[model samples]
Target: MQEVGSAGTIAVARRPEHRGRSLYTQALFRLLTQKPMGVLGLAIVVVLVVAAIGAPWMAPADPNALASGAKLEGPSLSHPFGTDNLGRDVFSRVVFGARISMTIGLVAVITSTVISVAIGVLSGFFGGVVDLLFQRLIDALIAFPGLVLILAMVAIFADTDLPGLPEEGAISTPTVVLMGTIGFLLGVGGSRIIRSAVLSVRASTYVEAAQSLGAGDLRLMRTHILPNVLPPTITLATLGLGTAILLEATLSFLGLGVPPNIATWGGMLNREARSWMTEAPWLALFPGLALSLAVFGFNMLGDALRDVLDPRLRT
Candidate 1:
């Protein structure tokens, strides 16, 4: 009888430890051990992030500085990816463009996650009045057509210069704010997804036990509810990255993103879109390729993460 009692106590102690290791960690380990493609995608994303963050230092040539003699040059040992119409090295601009692309994606995803998670959590946990009001608001937001909404936001906010009037080619605060705002709006779906999960989990055995034990709403929500929702939330966040990147690119393509001088992949595509397929295909091809690769990288990573983080997928 004493041994059985001791075993029960040990099992109780270990339960917290077991729950501490989220499904995400197990999924991650499974991917690393069993799936090589997921690892490759993750590696590519990391490299791109590093390159984007270190653009000024890592790039061999000035991305913006004109090379009058090198204009329209083809790919060669001297200039690997060749030069664009204005003599800016295509390779260097593409490298720097990675920064622009990634900044928008990462920032937008983070903003979206924060807003969505907060709204979703409050609605799902508290329910009643809070949930009713929030759900209505979300429904209203969703009523607007997606592309039209983004276009309307860009048209309203687009400008030739930053608000405080920093010199040309500097980081554009207004543009970033606009992109981040759009990102947050788009990210609202994440919260709704989490809210649904929360609704289901709120009635689960452990949650009811926590409530019965007199845990405060905050404690029950944060300690018991939030942790359970994190794995799927992370997966959504990862997938949302690809969506945000695509939106930014589309906005840029429509001339609604970034300033004229900034050279994001979308910006470059817009600039070079005129006659590139006929005259200089490389101009359009390179940036388009970069954008595709960025989207591809995030999507692949997200898929792998989903497989890894999703509890249902685990054997």
Candidate 2:
């Protein structure tokens, strides 16, 4: 390309050989290269996902099937993680439990992200009365201890029968309710982070310029605010994944989560496992290790993503 200089001389401009990589691509590259922990975290997450997806084929035995003759047997080639008190294969149950934990965590994070973004964007963009009302509501929700609030909500709705809903399926009513409650609580609290991001974007010169150009509130928000706020929101959602999984486990351990019949890591650690833990340590050890690894992996990944995605933190 040629451009005329101030002195009327022609100058040549050369286009780059290739286009720059996308933000996410660059972030991924950095995650793989610069962050060792992030790579390990991602690996763990992938393994868990694979385990959950392949549970049917990979599990050596039916997770719920009882083998009275093999009850509480120690680890061996037949059962890598040994048998539980009910003679259920601990390894099989752990693999199956991954499905439950991953599904609930993902659903809860997605739900919380939607709620947080909606509330945060509206409340922050429209300030004044709208902000006040939303903030007050958020405050009320935040005032209570999160776990206690969730416990109360779950307890109240646990036995409430819903017509036309199947008692058993890919997801049960009780499980759905549990996920929603966790999502709602996390979302309301997480809104504060999004709201702060929106406020920062709202005060930017570009936002004022957009407004000066006769852009509507919705247009400004969609074109400018939303894009800017997404980085923080994504980071928040990633971090929320670990929290959601841990919270589900806690609820299950307390006997307030999914049904006892269903296999879950937390349920595995319940009364039977606790009682037999001294006698057969593998019962708690394997499930606890799985839970710890899952939460650790997500948390590490989230931290790495936050560092990579945040402009302020970017190198």
Candidate 3:
């Protein structure tokens, strides 16, 4: 009897180990068989992430530093992408701008993920008054015009500043704030999706078995429900980062975002909107192209991830 019980424990442990190995092998095979779009997207995303992370050290010169005579110069051997209105290197600003764009995307997405996951897991697991209240709250938020709501939030928080952030933090103050505000609102979508996923998972036989085995609610949620919900949530969160970045650029272009003195691709386009289109088209072209490519890469990556990770999309 004792030997039989020990064998049962060994089998149970081996089950999880086998599952882990299977998952790893599946992931490897998927990666090896990735489509051209997926490969290209991953490459571009890697480049963008590297640029964003290495911005400070990689910038040719001070992005904010102004040299009076260099203003409005076209791309040359000396000034590759030329200088902006204030004589700051456009290339430098754009490089540094990557930092800003990526930072906001990363930070806001993290914040959104945490808040949304909590709201979603609790709402789905409880499924009573707790669910009802959260559902209504999220519904109301969804009802608002997304961009308009973000702008309103930005306007409200325009005067508010974080006490601990360094002074150099805001290259385009308004744009960062707007992106964060919009990103938070967008988080609600993820939360709602997660809640629904959780609901479905709660009905699964494994969940019922766990409950019958006297596993507590918290344990069931953390160990079982959350894991099931994460695959889809990861896909959503990645795609959402691209959307948030694009929105920030749009807001910046409309003069509702970062300041002129700061250098972002969007800010650069806005500053040179009139003259750069004619005199130095590369000024607008390269930055705009980069932004589009960045968005496209992330989107393709999300699609690939869905195909690879989502059970619904799996063959």
Which candidate achieves the best TM-score against the true structure?
2
The true-structure Cα RMSD of candidate 1 reads 3.6
Best by lDDT: 2
Each candidate structure's TM-score, on Cα atoms with residue i matched to residue i, is 0.88, 0.91, 0.86
Model 3 poorest 10 in a row by lDDT: 9-18
lDDT at 250 for candidate 3? 80
Q: Higher-lDDT candidate among 1 and 2?
A: 2
In candidate 2, the residue pairs with backbone N, CA or C atoms under 3 Å apart (3 or more residues apart, or in different chains) clash, namely none
**Model 3, range 111-211, lDDT digits (tens) per residue?**
67887888899999999999999999999988988889877877786676656543334634455566568667768878988898889888876777667
Residue 308 displacement in candidate 1 (angstroms): 1.3
Question: Which stretches in model 3 have alpha-carbon errors above 4 Å?
Answer: 1-25, 166-168, 171-179, 257-259
Model 2 C-alpha lDDT versus the unseen true structure: 0.86
Compared with the true structure, the alpha-carbon lDDT of candidate 1 equals: 0.75
Cα lDDT of model 1 by residue, 37-74, tens digit: 77877887888888888999977799888989988888
Off by over 4 Å in 2: 1-21, 168-170
